[model samples]
Each structure stands twice: as structure tokens, then as C-alpha cells.
Target: MKLALGPLLYYWEKQTVETFYQQALTSEADIIYLGETVCSKRRELKTRDWINLAKQLADAKKEVVLSSMALLEAPSEIKILRQICENGLFKVEANDLGAVQILAENKVPFVCGPAINCYNASVIKLLINKGMQRWVMPVELSRDWLIKILAECTQLGIREQFEVELFAHGHIPLAYSARCFTARSENKAKDDCKLCCIKYPVGRPATTQEDQQVFVLNGIQTQSGYCYNLLNDVPSMQGLVDIIRVSPSGTESFTSLQDYRAAVNGTGSPIQLASKECNGFWHKIAGFQTQQ
Candidate 1:
């Protein structure tokens, strides 16, 4: 299976983001997704910069994809989305329906990102007809769900039309909202709030009353508190998935990529799950619970 590095969900400074991708050049990642998929206000790198970065990674013999924002609330966001879709160089991952519409209208072959609520084979078929090149299964879906969907696709003879990507690692992106949760947590309004998300590299952990981490607040995106790991489940993904995606989480991103590479290559034994990691969604349980 191919290894893909998902877009950076957290906000970081320009240099930090640049440095991360620089290190990614030599990492085990076969595919690297660029662009900011969270809040557009986190403009440490603009559209031109992302396209430039994608070019650099593409030139390095790595398949590069430009990811779009999950929640777009302004015309300016649409304008930027158009620019990404029209970049004409790298594939674009459509995180929202608006992006899907734009890419479809332009007849561009695009990736249906995890944020898109594509739950059935029918949607997959429709997207394929609209020029979807790949489908990144929603993070919350289970293995059984995927098997059923792929079966349906096979029955319909559309299974071979597109590749299936699974969000195999990193924190699960649970939801996106119009409100900036990070700004609100800092007692600031969404508009006037300073760029506070950058202070917490991986996002501010939201804990339950019992002092258990339940969610991570990153700008407008809400992610699962525990990292979603599938290193032990690589064998299960053999024929079912074409690519395994690892979301960027900070300094450990490259190490996690290497670990996944080893697991995929059979160069390492099954790694034990950490206390902060879970693979419940893949096992059809509560998303934050690790299946033993």
C-alpha cells in the first residue's frame, strides 16, 4: 500500500510549515498533501506558496495533492478554492461539496477528501462520473462499512474506477464549524481574535469533567482527543485500500510516517498502541476507544 501524508490540520508559522515539508522530502511518505484544510485565516502560507510547495514535492518524485478547506464561509475562500482547482499541476482534494462542484464543473480529476460526507457506493459512483480519481473514506467509517461499500461498487462495476484511501493515522477530524473554537476558548471573538491556534501546535486539548481528553480544538476544526492509529491493522488493508493517509501532528509526524512505512513494508513488528492512541472507529466501536 502507498503511504500518504495528509494536509496539516493545525496552524503553524510559515517557517515551521516549510521545515516540516522539507523534512518530508526524505520521509517514507509516497504521497504528500499540501495546503491548509482548516481555517483560511491561518494564512502563514498563501495559495501561491502552497502551489509552490506542491511543485517542489512533485519534483521530488512524490505524488502531491492540494487539499481544500473543510469549512468555507466567504467568497474569498471560494476564490482561493478556484485557484487551487485551476492550478493545473497537482491533484486537488475536495473537502467540501462546494469544492466538489467547482472541480466537477471544471472537469478536473480530484480526490474526495475525508471531510466530504460520502458514505455509500452510490456517492462514490456519482463522484467517479464527475471525475473523482480517489475517495478518502470518512474517518468515522468502520472496516465493515468499507467492505460493504466496496462490494457494492464491485457489483456495480465501478470499484476499479477509483482508488480508496483510508485515514489510517493521526487524530480523527470529527467536525468543522463556522465558529472558531480556539478563538472562543481564548475569550476572543472569531473576527478580532489574534491567531491563537499557532500557540498550541497540535491544538488545545478539550478534556471532560473527569479530566479525560475528549476532543482537540483547532481553530474551527474539532478532532478526537486521542490519535487514530492503524499500524497494527495494515495487514487488514491489503486489498481493500490503495493508500494509507497519516495526518500531520507535529514533530512526531515524520517518526509516525517511518513507523507506518515499516509496518506497511513488514520491516517491523506490530507496534503497541500508546495510551493516547485509538483505533476504535476501524473496529466499529466508539471512536476514542481502542479495540484490544
Candidate 2:
């Protein structure tokens, strides 16, 4: 199995973002995904800058993929989607139908991102027929569900020949909305909200009345409370998934990516505790707690 570093879901300073990827180039991650998939208001890096970064990573022997925004609200967004489709160098990750259409129209071999809701074999085959090079299961999909889908694919004679990637680790991105919670919390309107999400680097953790961390808030996106850590599960799931994706959380200097890569390659020692790690959705359980 290989390690893929997913796109940065949070907004960071331009220099900080660039430096993170530079360090990630030498990390245990084999594939690197570039571009912003979150709110478009966060413009720390332009499209050209992302392209340049992708090129630099590609030069360093890492497979690079450019991700599209999950929500495309305007014509300008479509134009940006067109630009990503027209790039024609690195592979594009389609997060929305608009991106899928653009990539299909341009005949670009692309990846169907985790947001595509591909829970069945027919959907997978449809995308494959449209030139989808790879398809990632949604983060909420569980092990049994995945097995069933793969079985159906086998029955249909389309059993994930291209590649199958999973959101193996990170804060599970639960949902996105038109309303910006960061703005509301800061007493600002959604339209003129002064980029309040920049205040939370790791995102504002949502807790219950008991003060238990339950979710994370990022502008309009809701994410999981416990960061997903599936380091221990990789060995058993060897051939099921081609790449294990490590979504960006804190700074990239911590070497967790390398640790995951080591764990996947069976070169690193195993941890005693899988209880602390979460495989809830992967195991088809309630997501707040672990499932081992």
C-alpha cells in the first residue's frame, strides 16, 4: 500500500503552506494532493501557485493530484474548474459533479474524490467509462459496505482495476453548508465576515454539554471530533486499498505522515493501543468512538 497526503482543509499563511509541502516531499507520503477544496475566500495560494507546487512535488518523485472545490456556486468557479481540467499535466480530483463533467469533457483521466458518494459498483463503472482513473470511497463508508461494493464490482466485472484510495486517517469531513459558523460565532454576517476561520488553525472543536469533543467547525464545514487514525488496520487491508490517504491536520513537520507510511510498509513497530485509534465508520459503527 502507498501513502497519499490529502489536500490542506484549513487556511494557512502562504509561506507556511509552501514550506509544509516542501517538507512533505521527503516524508513517507508517496502521493501528494494539491489545490484548495474548501472555501474559495481563503486565497492564500492562487491556482498558479498550486500548479507550481504540484510541479515541484512531481519533480521530487511524488504523484500529485489537483483537487476541486466541493461547492461550485458561480460561473467563476466553473471557470476555475475548467482551468484545472485544461491543465492536462497532473491528475485532477473531482469533488463535485461540475468537476466530473469538466474532466470528462476535456477527456482528462481524473480521480473521483471522497465527496463523490460512490457507494455502488454501477456508479464506479459509470465514472470509469467517463475516464475516471481512480475512485475514493466516501469517508463515512465502512469495511463491510466496502466489501459488498467491491463484491458487486467483481460480479459486474469492474472490480477497481484503476486504483482504490481511502481516507484512512484524519478528521473526517462530515458536511458543508452555505452558512458560515465562524462568522456567526464572531457576530459577523456570512457575506462580509472577515475571514474568521483563520483564527482556528486546527479548527474550532465542537463539544457537548459535558465538554466532550464531538466535532470540528471550519467556516461552513463540520468535521469529526477525534482525528481518524487507522495506522494499525493497514496490514490486514493490504490489497483492498491501493493508497492510504493522510489528510492534513496540524503542521506537517510532526512526521506522522512518515509514521503512517512506515506502519503501512510494515517497516515500523506496531503500537499496543488500537483502542485509542478510530475505525468506527470503517467498521460501521457510530463515528464518535473507536471500533476495533
The clash numbers for all candidates, in the given order, read: 0, 0
User: Candidate 2's residue-wise lDDT over 221-245, tens digit each?
Assistant: 8888887877777776776888889
Candidate number of the best TM-score: 1
Q: What's model 1's lDDT at 223?
A: 93
Q: Model 1: per-residue lDDT, tens digit, 1-292?
A: 8999999998999999999999888888999999989988989999999988888888889999999999899999999999999888889999999988988899999999999999999999999988999999999999999999999999999999999999999888999999999999999999987999989999999998999999999999999999999999998898899999999987688888888888888897876799999999999999999975
lDDT of every predicted structure (CA atoms): 0.92, 0.83
Tell me the lDDT of candidate 1.
0.92
- Highest lDDT: which candidate? 1
* Candidate 2, residue 111: how far the Cα is off, in Å: 0.4
